[model samples]
Target chain A: MIAALRARNPIKPGKLRLGIGDDCAILRPNAGDELAITTDFSLENVHFRRDWHSPEAIGHRCLARGLSDLAAVGAKPMAAFLSLALPKELTARHRGKPAWVERFFDGLLALAAKMNVPLAGGDTAESPAHKGKAGLVAADIVLVGGVKRGRALLRSGAKPGDLLYVTGPGLGGAGAELLALERNPSRFTALKVAAPGHPHLYPEPRIAAGLRLRKRGLATAAIDLSDGLSTDLHHLCGESGLAAEIDATVVPIHPMAQLAEAAGWARSALQLALHGGEDYELLFTARPQTKIPRELDGVAIHAIGRMSKMRNGKPAVTLLEEGKAVSELRARGWEHFRGSSSD
Target chain B: MIAALRARNPIKPGKLRLGIGDDCAILRPNAGDELAITTDFSLENVHFRRDWHSPEAIGHRCLARGLSDLAAVGAKPMAAFLSLALPKELTARHRGKPAWVERFFDGLLALAAKMNVPLAGGDTAESPAHKGKAGLVAADIVLVGGVKRGRALLRSGAKPGDLLYVTGPGLGGAGAELLALERNPSRFTALKVAAPGHPHLYPEPRIAAGLRLRKRGLATAAIDLSDGLSTDLHHLCGESGLAAEIDATVVPIHPMAQLAEAAGWARSALQLALHGGEDYELLFTARPQTKIPRELDGVAIHAIGRMSKMRNGKPAVTLLEEGKAVSELRARGWEHFRGSSSD
Candidate 1:
């Protein structure tokens, strides 16, 4: 299997002193720089599924999952290593859909090509069990990206009273997922309430927004809104060692979210806006009243909340319902929300 | 989970610009020009037994496996990303072995601290099954390191007439496992191959030797002895697009192997040397007469083979039996060794 893999793809980069087919890949970075490296995993069923997700989706998703971490830290991806596990059922599935895995690679390569990311080294193994019930096919994607000397973003930069803002419209992503999985849906996909545009499958990660935010010297602290508003806001607040007050009424809701509500589907656009996961949007805290633009690369900035002090004595999020303050908004589903709770 | 994880880690780096919350980790490369990245996985039943592998071991083994990959690649380890799948068999086995897990972190951290590597960012998820037999826990470790660029080794650099060599002793690792698992092996632990060596418990990746080789410019091509000599040689040879020949007598045999043989065991040292996996020794190639060192850091480099063009239009490996060239090796066990071939 290693030999066959070796024959299939011989790494051909001048900078790649060594690549696939070895225990690890060897490379040279710029003349004087520290390498930015990170690893992430995509397990069957958890990150993906053989029954539902195609290998192509699996590959693309896994690759993106890893690269996104690099992006979150504002690093330019350079190299990657992958480790994959195969189950018995996958053999026939993989064989029958030769393109399944290949398409996944193609998806990954497309992004890699766009990003100039190179494949480094990886290992593959079959599950100890033949049945799918007992084993998991897994992959760990490692990325080596570069940051200019003296400038990598970290999580501890926010201070008291920093303005909490997100780079793109929020709340639409979770709403979009509802629309996609819905048994019936019409107005949600295009209506003003949903704007189910970029949320369902591929919400863009804010590589540029982060760069722009940094370049403008505005964002004091930043994090990606992988989790929804309520939770992610709590995170930036917690990291900053502060608290926050968010006006839940003004949250940018998805167009479809309103329609879904009419169907007795318990969804508040505000709730979706606050707690959905995998939105991949950029949520950052900047100096209050910093001269900000309407958009960066055409994505608007929405200020839903302002970071505050911990004077209330408890870390909390308050929602505005019919002009009244409510402690919580429970519109996002358990699965759609992100928290350190279950993970 | 993402929110809680973000809370725990806080993407806060004093020196880094883009830290825990961004898409990718963006950090300036230090005053060095090279970056090396590696990824590895620890699967239940394959790398660890569910019954024996505590969560701490699961955690420690995950990082160790990845760091070892960096070591094999000859990179100075830097940072890592860990993706963990926690099976529900949460043990008070030390309260989910949190301290053990922390010790696992300490093991990697202590080494990383010495090696200047750090625990960067990671994600955790509960395994699908809620019970021990229900599933296995897996962790993928991604390691980032630095190299001198262009000076990194390759498995495809060996030319015809180049010599084949392996770093460290082989098979004694598998031999150690036998003793470690045996009930009355207190006698074997005193032996050099067994004492202070828990091969199955801890597979040492030869980081120092790899770094030394990179610094000294010794090896032409390199691969770690992951799937035994027989399979790994095929990898080295196959990548260089050549064939190999080895002297069965020249191979080093572990001390425990000899003892096992003395005890009326049918297993030959040669078989273990050729087929045992996870020796983690470096199988490197160099030009013939290139001062094949007798020992590297106390481990001998056995001259096992030479690269060659196909003789008589056949890709084969010959062993000197009765001082006559007998073709005894084909690509017979590479696939089987890795379980990549259908039984």
Candidate 2:
């Protein structure tokens, strides 16, 4: 297993003094830089099901989870470690070889290579029991990134007047994909227009855009859209000690949102735009005076809301339509213990 | 879950610029040191069973696995992260909360506090299906440590003439504890004398001893006794292109080994010492002529073997009984995917 991983992940020279094959990978951070580390746990039946996701897609999604967190902080990836807990059945040798394990690494390594993130070191173990019973398979990713000292983008730096923007193709629509995929997989496939619109399964983490935002002093506070716009904006608001006033009509709805609406569901495109999660887009608050561009290196930026001072007896997130308060955004998103209701 | 972890793990003021609750943890390493990162995945059924082990033991063992790797390289831990994949059934709100999860962190945080390894950051997620069905629970720990720029030990630096040493209260004996624990939990409980001998369940990573060994330039190559004496020695031999010659008579047998033998197990004490794993002891090679002390701090150092120039087509490990070659040691040990035969 170790040999297979090392072969799939070729040692990247420079910066990394030592790589995989060691007891602990040795890394040297650049002078005047601070290291940023984030971890994400993806599980079978929870994050993805075997029937729904290919081995490669599972691998791609696992690493993307951690990379998205790095993007939220505007940090560039240095290296990553993976810890896999496989059901023993999956690890069973077929024709005297581990074919499935190799394929899984192929998918994971492909994404790592595309993002310039080196797969440094990790551990792999199987489930204890295998009395011919299938169990859960999990992948945990730990990403180490670096940023200039005192310059990391935080979720608590937004002021009351800060403008809130959602980066990448859009937000909220990504969550709608999960809803469609779970309710009816066949419909989800038929509704898909192209690759860029499938935000749930194939999330493109805004790594480069995040670094650019930090380097150019564009975003004051930032967070990844993992738990939908409503909940995520609430998190930022709580951290910044402010509330958010969102213009519901201006929010960009995903192409799949139309499919969800056509199915005669109670939710409209606007509702999906506010409550959907797993977008992996960058949601940030910027100074109102700053001249923000509509696009950055191909990523579309859309103004969705503005940070507002908390008014007595008001929710953290307020929905505004035609400059009048319509309703409050409730804390609803993809929660771990919460059942399929979140999806 | 976040509140429980924070309450248990108090922040230590120092190089940690930013800790948990952020998108990514920010750490600053010392100017002249390099960072060492290791990850260990502890899975339910594989590493521990919900019935056999307490929630606390599961958490402690998770972090211990990663810390042992850091100890093998003689690095001082700076901080650690945990990624947990929990079964949703365990997280159900039953009498106003998750008591088991809190206890799990209680045990994990206690160890981190004792080791001075701060709980930096991590991720938590639950299994999707929790309609009264049990799912897998797993924890993956990522430990970041530090060692002087050029002093971190490698497993490939052993010379032919170097003397092999096993540090900490002998190794092989600890693997016997697991066998006893699995075959008959009651018998294992009755056999336990005190804490010092129960190496398998409550392992004290030789972190300080490893640091001392590296700083004094006493050990050339080192590895943690995680995969038993036979396989780990084979790993070191493969890396250094040298073979090992161990005297079977000098191997320390755990007190529990006798219990396993009394229970009519086929394996003897010496056999358990050679093939049993999860010892978490440090095995290294030092200059034969060096006047090494019998003890460093409180850890016991035992010279069990010697590194020898490899003869083509010979086994990596040779076992000697009473100064005569009894047989060659085959690379047989606990393997993840190799079925129950390995366990």
Candidate 3:
């Protein structure tokens, strides 16, 4: 994770100086206001499992998870610190020693290195006495970002009439997640697995997307779709004291993910796409008619929802079906109380 | 950990401003340079175990482990996040009701609140998929501390003539660690099992002392002894390109610790004191005669060594029995690869 993270680190400017891979990652607070900070942990059982993903893939996704949260608030990641726990069984399971850790780093650190993000201080210790019986390992990744004073994006920033748009294909992560869960996933078409896993394993955090949204004065309110579209949208609506209108067909699910062949599984896919967590793509609200580009780096731009008044004025999510109002839907996103690892 | 951490947080004015508890901790740059940021994780097993610590105590110490590192470089903690993986067993064993988490918060959040530190964001999950296996818990604390345009503490800053002084008692943690490992630890000295539960349960991080050293412009080079005296001192010396001399008799040990009674154990205690890791006290070098208080807070302030030319230095540590040198010395602090978790 460290080496991969180090590999893509950008050449920091003189003022944005840092030393990665040290006792503590060191940097100068050259800014006038205080710095923005956030942390997120991805565990093996709760977040990801080795049986379903590679170490590098896990490393990359976890860092992206942290950074996406930072970007949700319009902060630019400056450094990442990774604290990892390894079961004693890792060495026995993976024959070669450093190679496993190295490959894991290859996926994990590569994302940070690209952004010149320093991999700072962290501790590594033996796994809990559980010995991966839960069939997973765990890691926590933290991103320290900087933003202009009081200019962070807030979920409450969304207002009535704001258009909800996403930067990339919205449902890719959900598709990939389902594929990951399947017994014979590779039997599925390559395209279905590619996009979601592309972002799922090694999410390209919309660091630049956030900056551009803020810079172009487009985003009024923003959030990363980490906890699936349903929960996040509800979260934004809850904070803004508003309701929402999501057009189901416009959510931009992966074109090749033949989830619909499983009959209502397509709806589950939509639900997962809407409610499946770990899509680091940006789900932000802008002016009702912001002229979003036709595409960004070939990823499709999506306009699947709109902020609205609460019915009789209550905050809720209303899905559109055949030009008629749907029941006030409970967002089927990952809920801490739900107790399910998958949405 | 959050409560205790909050309790010790120092308030600062301006854009370094943001509340601690949030989806993501917010920071606006101060205005001058970029922000210096870092995150660190402390995990159970890798960091601590429930068998040895009270929830409140564990909370405070786990978080403090990272804070001390920040203090070494004069960084103010901005926000902290916690990712707890509680096994059904340990959680229930510790009155696993959610209120226990609150108790954990009582000390943790208090510490953060004390410092005006906030709990920005974090996640909680079931422990490594088992009921009886040891649980996994992690705290990822991100520090957004200010440093002058070109100033921050570095281990490499010591000059040739710098004197090395450590705050608080040195070998006390080692003494405590011994108690924690014994099958019949209760049979140990009363001083050992007193309020603090020996060095095992709570190793007070020397944040204040390190910060004072930084603010007063005392130490030229500094590092917290998370690893042990031998390795940490060696790290400082190696970084500074200097040899060090630590007088054996001058090193402090906990008063009630009876580890010294056994034959090879006295030397072992000395070795533990020198290199026993996780003391989290500061090891720093200053001018040969730099004036510092006799004690920091209630902790002792002792001068045990000095930086010297490396030409003829045999072992970095020595025993002065009746002021005569003894040759049985070897570096025997905690080795991550070879050492057991005991020390």
Candidate 4:
């Protein structure tokens, strides 16, 4: 299996001194760089449904989760290690090939190639079955990235008077697409390849924007919108020990989300835009004096809010709605154990 | 839960620039050192049985599997990233504490501290259940270590005349203890703490000995005995393009295996010594003329075999029996999807 994976994704000689078939993969980072490591899990049902998701989508999203985290910190992805557990039937040779697993890697390695990261090392095992029932597939991805020492962006650097910005034109497309997937799964069966507009299936990690923000020293703090905007903004505020107020009128609603609302597939576009998760867009804060660009690396950027001092009675996040209405924005995002929702 | 984990394992101010609660953990490797990364999976029933092993034991063994890999390459332990999925019931608060998960971390963090590695970062989620049956627990550990540039002990560096050696006095203690646990599960319930005698419950990784070998330039090739001697030796030889020959009489059988054989619990101690796995011992090769020490870092070492030139018709590995009869040694170690066994 390791040989098969290696053959499919040939290792390009550079930072990785040793690839697979060893005790450990050896990486030689550039001289003054610190390594950033993150791990994320993609479990069946918790993160995706086998019935609703194609194997390609499942594999793409698994690697995307880790890459997004790396991008949030403005790190260049160096290597990725995937640990996968599949049911026995999924691994059984069909026509002398394990097609499902191969397609899964096809999706994963595609993203790795685009992002210039190597699939360095991994471990594979059969997911355990019980009482004759098939086991759920689970994959854990560990991403190793490199950033110049002391320059990597962090969530706790936001200060009062910092302007809040997000990459891309909008949010909530992933959630809207997921709703569509749950309602009519067959509509997306043809969506096998990864491209733009399939937000839920292949949400692009904002690596370029993050790198621009860090390289130009424009952002004071940064985080990826994995959980919904409300929850993740709350995380940024909590980490920075500050409060935030975002104008609802300025918050860009994804076109798909707007279409979902018009089609009666979702309740409200604004609600979905604020609370939907898996956007994979970068949410960052910049000094008010910094001349933030309208678009970064071809992705539209919008200033939607500002950081504020934490008052004794004020909520962590406040939403300024239209007609001068204001309300506390609770973090209704995908939090594990709190609800049956995927993050 | 992340906060609780951070509280318990407070980050020491050192190489880790950022720990948990961030997008990614940041590690600043010492100048000129290369990074070694490895990942391992611990799935329910496949790696550990809930009834046979305690949560602490499961956790310890999980980290040990990854640490042993780092040990094989003679890398100094730096940090560990763990991604865990647990059944909801196991994560539910009981008596104001999530006891099972906490105990699992207790076991994991204790080993990390002992080996001077940190609980760097991880992801946690509720394992998905199906048909109302509790979902299996799965934990994947990724260990990142550092070794002097160009000095990592790899499996491909051995020559035909190099001598093969193994750490510790014996092999198969873990496999023997596993047999005992399967026959009488309750007899091992009292084994709560990690000690030398309980090889299966808390197998110690040969990190020290590996470091000694690398720093002193002793070993030409190395691998950990996670899979049994026969299988791991096959891997080493395949990588180095060499064959091996060993004396079956000199193969060190663990005292526990001998006891199990005497008690009729095992068919033969020799079989367990040769093919049983999870010993976490280092199997390495040194130059034939080198004055190799009998003990490395206080652990006894045994010279078991020598690498030989590969012959077209000869088996990859050969065993010389008690009466000087020669026979082929097949790799009967645990392989995923090949059999219903654990590695």
The best candidate by lDDT is 4
Best of the two (2, 4) by lDDT: 4
Q: lDDT of each prediction vs. the true structure?
A: 0.60, 0.78, 0.62, 0.88
TM agreement with the true structure for every prediction: 0.83, 0.92, 0.84, 0.97
Instruction: lDDT for model 2, please.
Output: 0.78
Q: Write the per-residue lDDT of candidate 2 for residues B176-242, one digit (tens) a residue.
A: 6677566666544332112346676667778988988988889999988877888888888888889
Per-residue CA lDDT of model 1 for B1-343, tens digit only, reads: 3443345444345334344443445544445446666666666666665445343434544665666656655776656667666654442256454543444454454444444555566666665652235656666776666666456666778888988887776564554354344435443322222113555445566777778776777778887765667767777777788888887777776665666555655266566666666666787878876776677667667777788875667655655554466666754432321253210
Residue B54 error for model 1, in Å?
A: 6.2
Q: For residues A1-343, what per-residue lDDT tens digits would candidate 3 score against the true structure?
A: 3444445554366434655533455555434433556666677656665656666676777777778877777777766767666665563535545555565666666666676676665555555454535324667777777666567777777888988888775565544545544544443323212133465555667777776676667788888877778877877887788888887777777542335325444455566666666677788888777787756545566787788877775539888776566656577766422242210
lDDT winner between candidates 2 and 3 = 2
Per-residue lDDT, model 4, residue A187, is 83
TM-score of chain B of each: 0.79, 0.91, 0.76, 0.96
The digit string of per-residue lDDT tens for model 2 on A1-343 reads 7776677677777557777787888887877788889988877777777656656667777888899999989998999998876765676668886455665676677778888989898887665543445656778899999898888998888998999999876555666666666776654433211245667766888999999899999999998888778888888898789999999878877777767788755267777777777888889999999988989878989998899899999888989997789998887865532442210
Per-residue error at B237 for model 3, in Å? Answer: 1.8
Ranking by lDDT: 4, 2, 3, 1
Q: Please give, for residues B191-282, the per-residue lDDT of candidate 3 as tens digits.
A: 21124534554566666676677777888888777777776777777667777767788887654244553533445555557656667778
User: Residue by residue across A1-343, what tens digits does model 1's lDDT show?
Assistant: 4454455446766556667656666666655444555666666655555554445445665666666555555556667777777665554544364534455565566556555677766767676672335456776677776655645454557777776676666565545564454544342322212112635434455666666776567777776655556666666566667776667766767665665566656556555566656666777777786877879878888876766667654445556654566675333434531122221
TM-score leaderboard ranking: 4, 2, 3, 1
Model 3 chain B: which ten-residue window has the lowest total lDDT?
B185-194
- Please list the residue runs of candidate 2 whose C-alpha ends up more than 4 Å from where it truly belongs after superposition: A88-98, A128-132, A183-195, A263-266, A335-343, B89-98, B128-132, B183-196, B262-266, B335-343
Q: How many angstroms is residue A223 displaced in model 4 relative to the true structure, after the best TM-score fit?
A: 0.6
